[model samples]
Target chain A: MHTETPFKTHFNAEQAGLESLNIKSSNITFVSVSDMLALINQYGVEQLMLGMVEYLEADFKRWLDFDKSPRFAAHSAEGVIELMPVADHQQFSFKYVNGHPKNTKIGLQTVTAFGVLSDVASGYPLMLSEMTILTALRTAATSAMMAKYLAPKQSKTLAMIGCGAQSEFQILAFKAILGVTHVRLYDIEPNATKKCFNNLQSYSKENDLNIEICHSSEEVIKEADIITTCTADKRNATILKSDMVGEGVHINAIGGDCPGKTELDAALLNRSDVFVEYEPQTRIEGDIQQLPSDSKVTEMYQVILGEKSGRTHDAQLTIFDGVGFALEDYSALRFIFELIKQNKEAQQIELLASPEDPRNLFGLTQTHSTPSA
Target chain B: MHTETPFKTHFNAEQAGLESLNIKSSNITFVSVSDMLALINQYGVEQLMLGMVEYLEADFKRWLDFDKSPRFAAHSAEGVIELMPVADHQQFSFKYVNGHPKNTKIGLQTVTAFGVLSDVASGYPLMLSEMTILTALRTAATSAMMAKYLAPKQSKTLAMIGCGAQSEFQILAFKAILGVTHVRLYDIEPNATKKCFNNLQSYSKENDLNIEICHSSEEVIKEADIITTCTADKRNATILKSDMVGEGVHINAIGGDCPGKTELDAALLNRSDVFVEYEPQTRIEGDIQQLPSDSKVTEMYQVILGEKSGRTHDAQLTIFDGVGFALEDYSALRFIFELIKQNKEAQQIELLASPEDPRNLFGLTQTHSTPSA
Candidate 1:
């Protein structure tokens, strides 16, 4: 019942015999954190964000083509670690990510991640890359892409409610993708807002963006075309109150992604037309988790697919509950895979044994034996 | 509520300040296939198998402590790619493995895998290793460990039905751990049998084992003390019939793992008392899948834990429906992790970003920028 594709019909190796276990070409590309930064810097963050948006949009437009599921999460008192897996016909991708809110207090990351992309034909990993930086880049691109569909056409200002690790990326992505020129930043801690403002000073000048630090969420909540909430707090904090939000504004709610972790008040969700990444996952992990299970919410794919309308009226309040999904990570990893193919600095590692004789795996240990120190 | 341990309490780096993004200490150890083979060769296959047997037994004895689930599988037209994850309080491990029975025809392995072991406390990967060899080692160890309890006293002969890649490892492990000095090898493909025999020739001489090649399964079925069936056919092919079997023999069924795949006949399963790894998964994927949904079976853990008896009578037929589980991979990865810690040959890769100020992930990318090629 299965027809062989050209890639699967024949062996690409020079030694096309089962006994030739010498791996001339490795299937896995290992991109470290430094290498990933180099690759992204080579392309430039603005260009990378634009490219990611295209991939994200492409995947979302054909949402039915991908297998989607709520990530399997293992929760502890300290934090949560999750495995998010998704696959299409040709390839499969998964990310191992953790959200440890208390990590920063001990000089550790509140979030860190790595991912692998494998060919569905052979099940060998094509690439393994550090997803810490990639996740930040993709998360911003997803927000901006959603805002492009939901926000008003001439949206120029972004109210960044929490200016932390992800804030600068969000600001830059908005400027690059959505033509957002002004950003009003706010954080509970003044030092955090200051750090974000100082770090973005050169980028803001280079991109011709007006970046200002606001004293409070209310100070910028009413005056912005788009509001992005990305606070790192583990609790349900109302970063944006219902009464403070203005009409015709697009809310890019990025925080409150896990259960019992929310940024928007329940009343705010009730007041806005909610759109989500995936309904089942978003209902459990997004700000919509605070709302009723039967609540009406439009899937963002429906808008991208042109099946549902986004921001029907100029005065409408639109909310994209941006709980990051596996598809976005897949898009990011796929983008990295393409970016590093021509770049020689992308390291290759022999993650699987290719023996001359497939059955003589034990013989390799004898022949290729390295004296242990 | 959490007390800090010595490892978690202090920064072991010379640069203690958050501003020092320089990472002089790395937590990740990257053990490639060659390194894995070197390590295994250093420890000797028999000793490594013996060590894995201990780890496997310990893990199985405390099986209830593990968070177990049926592997998350992504099935395609060509094959299956699966992620098997397991975690206890201290460590978490998962393997990315693929099974394509037709891969050997194109000079590729039918099964190839890699895995990661991470610290549950920090949620960072501690070790990443090629598990193609490790899986073979672990599978053989687990079988031998089970045979230690299930096989008759002083069992000497192992009848290997299918001489595939894993056949040699099984023979060696049984010889080392269970003192099975005689092996009867049989395969429909004579080349496979030849390859297995040639690979075991030197090891057989060193270990004083009597290795003989058999033409058919029936030739050695009734004479052997332990019969191991590990054919590669994807469909149900009855390699062992009930009428051909003898009394008081232990059956190690490995190949009939996936759905619609069976090596032994249904009548044989009905006549034998089956023992399985993880009852829930075995019911769906093991040889028991051919039997009734509510068939009486014993869990391997129960036998190891003394909750259930193994080989009740002298004439009873004992079947071990061995559908590989995630815990075995965990044990193998853990064993590799300990073996490579003091070995300088084991390379370490920075698979994760360990910025001094964990919150300033964007800043690290900016400062550690590599010039674009």
Candidate 2:
């Protein structure tokens, strides 16, 4: 068993009495990619997603308490880099993420991210975690949590239109949260579908879940209770046409989250009862960007809070146009912070400056005598 | 001499042949407070600030190339946390900073910060650094750099009001960049003034710089060539009355930042020729916030580019109302990135995820077989 590292020891000491210990010992818990994988191994991916859904649902219910804004994005010729920040009364969190579709050609992930969680009172960061994997987890958890209130009851089949990096996570989240046992996958590249199918072999057998591969999106969603479109095109390419989506199917559109990027046909969006993570942001980056500015759409928080209707009838078409909100990242960071508290050996990094005398910041430089000529 | 760690090795290998190397080996250069102190000790604070001034001047000249926006702020009862992001065509940078005045009461610094520098082409972060110390350095360097263009020629004395954490850095920056040899300090708390005076003893002695402490802000500014106000009060209290300021003095007013927090009297602001960094932001957060929204003020970049006048004559009252722009942080991070390249032993952290197959993100969890019950 791993001994209590300074990360946990300091946290425990602080919890005992924040004023007793030297605040200099307060360091940020750092969750690397390897740490995240270790965590997933410690608790299965399905269980983590199940845990995350509760957080997502709880945070969404109190959405009005959060300070929300559209992400700050710096778009270049290649892609975009964005900073998403949201905070409640006690804690503040922000995620630094980037999207470059062309990165995979050079053997890099299309989207990579990291984030910080901080205390609102003292303004000191509590944790810094690798968010690429966590983002995939949270995105899926959010989708499945939304579908719990919006999808058909006991939804058993999910059709994933983009069988890329996010396909497996989406399938597992639906399985863990909504009892989705059948997954149908399709992609523009057949290799993506093959990879998705190959990855799920062991889990599918163990959990008694059925998996199938289809050559076309139309064929994939033929009887799917829920359809997920997550293609990575940087332009307004309609991967799902209005005629392809069947009645009463909840569409989970996750990709097409940038200004010029979208996945669903505008006509399909017009016909469905659209729900979004945050209206101001989704108006610019979500599939609703293709619709008129004044088009009718419901913010998902209202549905979660029981202020608005989610699934009015079995025949009503519901579409979740999630552009990804900052509040979800805040909840994910908050959840991970709690998990690390229980796991003693989580890594910590010296990310902040803690001078013995807080006001004498200049004294830190005088510690070493030798100065370079 | 320390050996080349995996950080520099991977960076070099990527530079030599980006397409040939596995991009998974790339990691972010992590500069802790200790690392920053090591850097300051190695090169000396004066030399580092001098080098930073050159970068600041060069960047300010080409300011139009940057994608700039007002910082995103989350304000609470205790304080505010802000994300300041700016990017050029090739590089992107942002700083995460918070200011809680009451933090010092609990033995925490009033302000703490960290930031990320990234490649705009790939949207991958290149470096992550502790900005608490660097922010002090950058803030001083920006003030002195502006004083170079705006201050009266060959000024010798600097009077600093509120001799707290930033006092010593401001004094050194003036000494190194503008050749100021005399200093006068005053603070509301006499102990803060004593602390500042004690900290600067060795540097003053070594460089033959004269130092004085005054009981009142009025006495401190007497015959001063430059006056700097940097009190940390969170309210609009006038530390400098208009009648107290004299002509031919360059005023560096930095404490009067944020919406309701200010230090200079409105009459003093009305009497001075104010120059600022990034006008849109200054209009909300700088000392100029006391003035009307349409009040005339010069953006400093234009002066650096020689498009506008700086100091017209010796008797003119000029003020650099700097609220700390994102561009300065960009320049500071860029400078540190270059410095760490020469110092091979700089620390690195695994802040980003790099799966072997970018599309097979699910495969990462499979590396460890046993799942918790």
Give fnat for candidates 1, 2 and onward, in order: 0.62, 0.70
Provide DockQ values for all models, in the order shown. Answer: 0.46, 0.49
Which of the numbered candidates is closest to the native, going by highest TM-score? Answer: 2
Residues A225-245, model 1: lDDT tens digits: 999999988888888889888
Q: What would the per-residue lDDT of candidate 2 be over residues A1-373, giving only the tens digit for each residue?
A: 0112222222221242223223355477788877788778877788777777767877887788889999999999999999999998777899999999999898888899999988877878888998999999999999999998899977889999998888899999898888888999999999999999999998899889999999998799989999999999899998999988779889999997999999999999999999999999999999999989999999988999999999999988999998999999988887777777676676777777777888989988889733121
Best by lDDT: 2
Model 2 superposed RMSD (Cα): 5.4
Model 1 ranges off by over 4 Å: A1-24, A371-373, B1-27, B371-373
lDDT of 2 at A63: 88
- What is candidate 1's lDDT per residue for B294-349, written digit by digit as tens? 99999999999999999877788899999899999988887777667657666777
